[model samples]
Target: MRSSSVLAIVVVLLVCLFKHGNSVPVEMETTTAMTTEFTATESSRKDIVFNSTEGEMEKPRYPHDGYCGHLEEACSDERRCCPDFECYHSEGRCIYLMQ
Candidate 1:
């Protein structure tokens, strides 16, 4: 019985992640010790936070063609993106603005 419940939790997690693009379970059964473990893990995951600092502040994006060096995919400053691409700080990804 306990093993089946654990397997169900694993199945639900994978189904939500791959088919629904969710990181957390939408609903859970509270009748088992495993539920408490899941709740603790989920709450702990949510408690984690990221804090940005100074000098490494995000900047605008710029344009550059291919060169001798390997181009970085992440955006941080003005030169990180192309002319049409803007650095979306909240999402931490480059977005095309000129389209």
Candidate 2:
């Protein structure tokens, strides 16, 4: 009877250890996945400027006429404008104003 009780205790301890060990790896995997996703998102935010000698154009005048309204509008029209009116190339977006 004593031996049976000891065996049961050992089994329970092993089960607890296995559960805890499995959880640690799962948590680590989740954290790594989140970090990878964040890095991919950050890289995508960077603008890809195309420079070709034949079709390349000079930088437009700063302080575009108006707000870009949307990122696509600014990129498609090649207008350097930002929502905050800051005229500068930032992250992959254009800031329209000087300040």
Candidate 3:
């Protein structure tokens, strides 16, 4: 009878250990969450420039060309484009200024 009781105790202890061994899944979940958050932060940063939206910092588009390397000069035309805004080369594409 005593041996049977000891066997029962050992079995209970083994069951507890098996249950605790599942902690690996919990740790993996935590690691995955942290990795996901880090990736999201990096993506968001990449899409931002000067703390402004990506659209605001977009490269200048030229009326004759696509992406203009002379965006600085293109931005100078106040009558055509908005002030303090950037320009990009849009080869042969006309710039539509909001009247």
lDDT of each: 0.52, 0.50, 0.49
| Candidate 2 lDDT, 1-99, residue by residue in tens | 999999999999999999999888443433434333435354334322234766664333334553243333333345545334433343545444454
Runs of candidate 2 with Cα error greater than 4 angstroms are 26-99
lDDT of 3 at 6: 100
lDDT tens readout by residue for model 1, 17-93: 78765555678657544433444465434433333664352332222532111123456643355445566667656
TM-scores, in order shown? 0.24, 0.26, 0.25
Q: Give, for candidate 2, the lowest lDDT window spanning 10 residues.
A: 67-76
Candidates 1 and 3 compared: the better one by TM-score is 3
TM-score between model 3 and native = 0.25
**Descending-lDDT candidate ranking:** 1, 2, 3
RMSD of 3: 12.5
Candidate 3, residue 41: CA error in Å? 45
Between candidates 2 and 3, the lDDT winner: 2
